[model samples]
Target: MLKEFTIQTPSEGFVTITKQVAQIVEQCHGEKRLCHVFVPHTTAGVTINENADPDVVKDMLLALNHMVPDLAYQHGEGNSPAHVKASLVGSSVSVPIVNGTLYLGTWQGIYFCEFDGPRQRKFCVNIL
Candidate 1:
């Protein structure tokens, strides 16, 4: 089964959507499968990271900006740097589903990467 979700990011930051995925798992109703989450946009991505601390997200953004500064990009598009960063990070994540639950670390959460702006984005979850 595959599902697509719409997310509205208020700003350029990490937005955790673990709960949404969990709900999707619940709706699967005892099916054991592998879950793949994918983001189709070049300026966006997905990851599993520490959810307990807000500072981690801040540090990540700061570090990425330091590594790939917007001014340094030559693609000319305002979001060219964002596309590069997303490529480095990636656009998909896979998780094991057992007993209808996602297997994740205690501190780990699924996040949608929004590097460009406050816009609507789509996250896809596929179970197989």
Candidate 2:
């Protein structure tokens, strides 16, 4: 099953969507399965990372910004850095679903990485 969700993201930061993903996973019935979370935006992506410490998110964004410097690109849009970051981070994450729950580590959580402006974004969840 595939479901879409909307989220308002910051100009450039990570938004923890663990709870929302979990809620979606809970709806599936029977046996162990797999869950895929996908972000449908060029400047956005999804990842599974440490969410217990807020600084982790900040550090990740800082590192990404540092790595993807604001340099001229062939693309007319000035959001080349965002596109690079999104490519580096990837657009989807897969997690194991056991007993209708996400089987993530204690500190691991699902995050939506937004590298562009504060805009409305859409992500999808697929249960298989």
Candidate 3:
């Protein structure tokens, strides 16, 4: 089975979407399946990481900014760096589900990366 949804990000940063994914899993009502989440965008990505600490996300963004400084890119759109960063991070995350729960590490979380400004983004969820 497959389900898709859209989320609006406020700005260029990470937005935790664990609850939303969890809700979808609950709605699935299946015994066991692989949950695949995919984002289709050049300037956006998805990842599994620590959401318990805000600083973790902050430091990550900071580090990424340091690595790929905003002013370093010469793309006309001014968002070429975002596309690069998204590519580096990736555009999807797949998690295993068992007993109706996601099998993730203790501090792991689902994050939606928004490199561009506030916009509507879509994600696909496939239970297989």
Candidate 4:
């Protein structure tokens, strides 16, 4: 099964979508399955990380920006850092679905990493 949703990111940061994805999984009838969440944007990505603390997300973004600071790049769009960060963060995440629920850790949550945003984004959830 497949589901898609849109999100509007206010700025560059991690937006938790764990609940949304879990809701989709809950609607599925399967007991055991693999849930694949994908971001189909070149300048954005997906990940699973500590959702209990907002600082974790802040630190991650800070580290990424420090590592890939915005500077002159060949990409004329001026979002080369976003592309690099997206590649490092990855475009998708897979979670195990058991008993029709996402098998995530206590502090883990799914995040949509927006590097170049304050814009509309779309992500897809595929259960198999």
How many clashes in each candidate?
A: 0, 0, 0, 0
Q: Which ten residues in a row have the lowest lDDT in candidate 2?
A: 22-31
Candidate 2 lDDT (Cα, 0 to 1): 0.92
Candidate 4 residue-wise lDDT at 4: 97
TM-score of each: 0.93, 0.97, 0.91, 0.97
Estimate every model's Cα lDDT from 0 to 1: 0.88, 0.92, 0.86, 0.94
lDDT of 3: 0.86
lDDT of 1 by residue, 33-58 (tens): 88899998889889899999999988
**Tens digits of per-residue lDDT for model 2 on 56-126?**
99999999989988786988878899999999999999999987789999999999999997999999999
Q: What is the C-alpha RMSD of each candidate to the true structure, in Å?
A: 1.3, 0.8, 1.5, 0.8
Q: Give the per-residue lDDT digits (tens) of candidate 4, residues 28-114.
A: 978999999999999999999999989999999999999997677999888899999999999999999988789999999999999
Q: Please, what's the RMSD in Å of model 3? A: 1.5
Candidate 2, TM-score vs. the true structure?
0.97
Off by over 4 Å in 2: none
Please give the RMSD of candidate 2 to the true structure. Answer: 0.8
Best by lDDT: 4
Ranking of predictions according to lDDT: 4, 2, 1, 3
